[model samples]
Every structure is written in C-alpha cells, then in structure tokens.
Target: MRVLVTGATGHVGRHVVAQLAEAGHDVLAMTRNPATAAFPASVEVVRGDLLAPASVPVEGVERMYLFPEPRTATEVVARAKSAGVTRIVTLSSGAVTGGFDTDFQLPVEQAVEASGLEYTHVRPGDFASNTERLWARMIRADRVVRYAQPDAPSLAIHDGDIAAVAVAALTEDGHTGRWYDLTGPELLTRREQVAAIGDALGEPVRFEEVSPVRAREILERQGGWGAENAGFLLGFDDYSATGPSFDDVDWSATLVPSPTVEEVLGRPARTYAQWALDNVAAFR
Candidate 1:
C-alpha cells in the first residue's frame, strides 16, 4: 500500500511516517521543506503544504494521514479522491467531540466525510509535547513552572501514540468510519506534570502558582502556541461563548483518560511520566 502523509515532519506526522515505513508500506512523506525533513531511508520525501493543496502529489496513493488545514481542506480532499486515494486518517482534535470547536478542525473533517473516501478521525486530547512549549524553557532556566491552575488536570496524550493509532487506521482494516477520541493512560494535575518532568531529570522542579491573568500575560509575551492559545487554555475565553467568562466547561468530565488508544492498538497508552522521560533532553 502506498500511503501519503501530509505534515509529515510534525511531532505526530513524523512518527506516522516512520511507523508506516517500519510496517513495510510504501510511504510518501509530504512536507513544505523536504530538505530538512528526515524519515527512514525507505520513505520517499516530497514537497507539499496543505495550505496550497496543489503542491500535494497524491498519484497512486491509496491512503493518507491528513493534517488539518481548513483553508484548503475541500480542495485537498477532492484532489486525493480524484487521484484514487481510498482512505484518509485525520489528525483532528478532541474539542470537536466536546462541541467547543467549529471553525478549525471541524471543517476539515466535514470535507473528508463528504469525499466518499473511507475516513477515520483521530481526535486526541491535550498533547504531552505541549509541555515543551509551555514549560521547557522555564525549567531549563530555573527548574520551576509558574502557572495558573496548578491542580487542574489533563490526560495529555503522547504524539507517538496518536501516530500509532493513525498508522493502524491507514494500514489495517476494521478502522474505517471510526472517530477515535484518544487520551493518555493517566490523568495528572499541572503540578504533578511538573513533578514528572523533574523526576525525569533527577531533580526537584518547583511549581509556583500564579493568577491566570498573570500567566496569560506571560504566555502572550513569550509568543508562539503559548501566546496564541493562552486565553483558551487558561479559560479566559471560550470558543462556544466567543468571549470572556470563566466556567464554560467541566474539567472533571474532560480530564479523564480514555481507553481508546489501548483498545485500538492492544497496548497501554503512554503515561505522562513516560512522556516526560522520553523527552527529558528538552527540559535539560
């Protein structure tokens, strides 16, 4: 089977490419910068960006691991179908399932569903890798994580685990038409997550509580994903409400770990502690 994986250099996409290659699939990794993209020697690297669907070459591709870019999703799915791609596994978000997301990933999902292609939606909750963006620099600088909601909990799924599910959907049967809501094996508080990172580094990492407003301000100043989503994550803004007002969600219901990863792959999903240990170098 020839599989084309877009966003093939991302945290999840890279794993999807590597896993597919390891599974003996003829993998085509689509990236915006093929020169910097790294994959197994057996994998083919091609230049493409979902923002410009025309750059993606789907010729002879039987399946795809699509990274959502709503701007061109309809066109991208059309091209894939025209080229005879039979199946597609999307890297969607849990927010879609929670009914809090409409503009971003939902549109992409709609496009794929309308394409008449076999589709599987991988809706993963908070990524374990997000810690690198939110706290890695702070840990490296002072071994401390200062943020709001220290007791707030999350089931932060591993990027590789997400890729594993996507790979199974792409290469195997019985996964089509499934919408998988995935999570890590355990739920941990913000403070506990910081502690896990410290444990991984063989040191004590302090968690200092701050006001959510203060934290949002700090994240905004830092820029990147932290800045972009500071309001949404910190609960200052709600997508459904479209403005300021706290308590739009019940964290207790949303933070529990899901068994879907283990159910789909026949193995335990990675824990937050294991994820920290696996990427300890980032904190160091």
Candidate 2:
C-alpha cells in the first residue's frame, strides 16, 4: 500500500511512519517543511500541509494516516477519496466522548466518515509522553505541581503503542468502520504517576496538588491554557473524584490485539523510570 502520513514529523506520526516502513509499506511522509522531517531514507518525503488541501499532491495514494485538527479536513478527505484512497486511519482523541457537538474532534470525524473511505478511528487516551512537558521542571525543582485530581486515574498509553496500533489499522484489513480506544495496561492517579516517575529516576518526586482556580491562574499566566482546556482539565478532575470509569472500557476485541510494549518495540515500553533515566540530562 502507498500510504501518505500527515503530521509525519510529530511525536506519534514519526513512529507510525517508521512502523509502516518496517512493515514493507511504501510510505509518503507529508510535512510542511520536508527538509525538517526526520524519517528513514526509505520513506518518500513530500511537501504537503493539511491546512492547504490544494497544495497536496494526492496521486497514487492508497491509504493515509491523518492527524486531526487540519484546517481543511473535509477538503483533504474529499481529495483523497477522489484519488482512489481506499483507507484512512485517523489519530483522533478521546475528547470525542463529549461528542462532536461539544468537541473539536467531531468535525474531523465527520469529514472522514463523509469522505466515503474505509476508515479506522484511533482514539487514544492521554499520552504518557505528555509528562515530558513537565518532567524537566520536576527534575530540576524536585517537585511536580499541577491541578491534577488526586483521586482521578488515567491509563495514559505510550505514544509508541498508539503508533503501533495506527500502523496495524492502516496496513491490515478488517478494521474498517471501527473505533479503537487505545489505553495503557494499568490506571494510575496523578499522585501515583508522579511516584512512578520518581521510582524510575531513583529519587523521590513530590507532587503538590493545586486548586482548579489556582491552576487556571497559573496556566493563564503561562499564556497557553484556553477556556476549553481549562474546563476539560477541571471537569476531568471532578470526574476522577468518583473514580475514572473510562479506564475500564473494554478493548479486548480490537481487530489488532493490543500488543504489549515489549512486543511492539522488541523491548519494554519506556517506563516513567526509563524515560526519566534516559532524559535526566534534559533536566539539567
């Protein structure tokens, strides 16, 4: 299959491209800046931006791995359909649980569904790598502070696992019209997550809980927390107080059986400890 992957340079997209290449699929790695795309030489890199659908050269594409939030998802899907693209595997978010009416993901999902292409929606939970954004500060200060609900638990799947699933869905058959919820094997609270990171680093990592109001203020000062994100975080916190039910959702019957990290990477998935050990230098 000739597969075109958008956001090919992103955290998960990069891994997806690698896995696709390893599986012997012809991969077209799409990026806005081809020069900056770090992918294997076997990948045919292309200059394309999802924001500008007209700029994409969609010839000879049999399948695609799409990332959500492109400016023109509908247009891009339409073009891919016209170009004889048979399958589309999208990297969608768990936020769609709130429904398309309230979530930004709905539009992308609608576009893909309407595209008339055989599609598999990969809806993954919180990414374990999202911790990297805060690990540096935690390592330096020896403390991790956030507006995390102490009682709420999340099964944060590793990005590599998510990518592996995407590759399977794109390359294998019998996944069409399916929505897979990819999550980690176990659920852990925010406090427990911090402890896990500390265990990985061979040190104590303290987690300080902040009130939602304080968290919002801090995020606002940082200039990156918008109202929607703030609401989502706070809502998630509230939901956690009752225990996270989403973590219990069944996924045993996926077309591609969930592969353990060790199985997918031929080594253990990078645990919080392993990640901390490997990236401790970034903390300095």
lDDT of candidates 1 onward, in order: 0.91, 0.71
Backbone Cα, N, C clashes tallied per candidate? 0, 1
- Residue 15 in candidate 2, Cα distance off native in Å: 1.5
lDDT of 2 by residue, 162-273 (tens): 8987887888776799877666666667777777767666677777788878766655554432433564566533222333344454533332323444443454444444
Deviation from truth (RMSD, Å), model 2 = 5.5
Q: By summed lDDT, which 10 consecutive residues of candidate 1 come out lowest?
A: 240-249
Candidate No. with top TM-score = 1
Between which residue pairs do clashes occur in model 1? none
lDDT of 1 by residue, 185-256 (tens): 887889999999999999999999999999998888889989998988887777645432346555667867
Q: Can you give the lDDT of residue 137 in candidate 1?
A: 80
